[model samples]
Target: MDQSYKKIEKLKGEKLIEKLFSEGKSVVAYPLRLVYLKTNFDAPVKIKAGVSVSKRNFKKAVDRNRIKRLMREAYRLNKSNYFNNIPDQYAFMILYIGKTKTDFETVTKKMNTLMDAFLKQQSLPKP
Candidate 1:
């Protein structure tokens, strides 16, 4: 796997986003929360991710963009940790939920923890 966040790996399109929100399940590790849903969209990669920051918390575009940048970089670097074991395709939305800005180290640490939680979640049989 390339392990890079390519344009094709970006989760977009109106219909797809709507379906994800409506059908996805979520896992959280403070400052970050991941909502993911199994996808049927044709694609080269097994996963596609979207990052978000609350507009209410970060009113400036710059602030939101900065946080998203950090989140993406963290995910990109550590994605391989659980990427190979994903048995199926999934679209993911990662949300930043902190009331204040946090450093890259904190975000990266939380991102790893979040992915671990997600992998563990996927391992258990669905109810």
Candidate 2:
């Protein structure tokens, strides 16, 4: 099985990003902002994705990279569960908004917790 989460197929254009956010739904988890604009595809598959960490919080490149990596990993492991039940497609962004650096495990736990709570609140179909 291919376990790849490549970026080439993910939407990265500024226009698309703007439109997705403009037309989609948003859920803020304080330090984690999830803006999702679902698509009209008949099948279940996430087309594109992106991650961003706040420079205002941690100015160091290493710290930013670490946080981004943690978020990506959490998404990679748990995204399929979120994608399976949704009726439409999604173009989304995960934004980190915090004042201090965090460990990977802590971030992952928080991300997973936030996702579960959001999905439950949305009443998205369960898998």
Candidate 3:
């Protein structure tokens, strides 16, 4: 399990992002929200993920960028544990919804909780 977050694993494209928000399901854990959509990719990867920090909340590019960086690092460190066994490819957008700044420890803890919630939701029988 490679812990590095490579450029190829970064989610991109405007249309795909729009579709993800409009059609995807989300799981929230405090400041973090994981919005996921099952989708096929030409690339040979199990997941493509992106992180976001709201400009409205942070009001500064530096603040937003820092939060995004924290979120991405948390995801990169924790993803393999949660996603390694899954066979389907997914697109994930992790949004930081809190108003204040947070530390890496808090982000990592919340990320673990968020991923647990996501996996629990995934295992449920769909109606």
For candidate 3, what's the RMSD?
A: 3.0
Off by over 4 Å in 2: 1-3, 40-44
Candidate 1 vs candidate 2, TM-score winner? 1
Residue 17, candidate 2: alpha-carbon lDDT:
87
Candidate achieving the largest TM-score:
3
lDDT (10s digit) by residue, model 2, range 12-91? 78877898878978777667887777664333354467888888888998999988998888877777766655655667
| Candidate 1 backbone clash number | 0
lDDT per prediction? 0.89, 0.72, 0.91
What's the C-alpha lDDT at position 88 in model 1? 88
Candidate 3 — number of clashing residue pairs?
0
Q: Tens digit of lDDT per residue, candidate 3, span 1-127? A: 4898998899999999999999999999998999999999999889999999888898989999998899989999988788888868999999999999999999999999998998888893211
TM-score of each: 0.93, 0.80, 0.95
Residue 62 local lDDT, model 3: 93
Full candidate order by TM-score, most accurate first: 3, 1, 2
lDDT of 3 at 69: 90
List, in order, the clash count of every candidate structure. Answer: 0, 2, 0
- Taking the tens digit of each residue's C-alpha lDDT, what string does model 1 give over 52-127? 9999999999999999999999999888767865668989999999989988999999998898888888893221
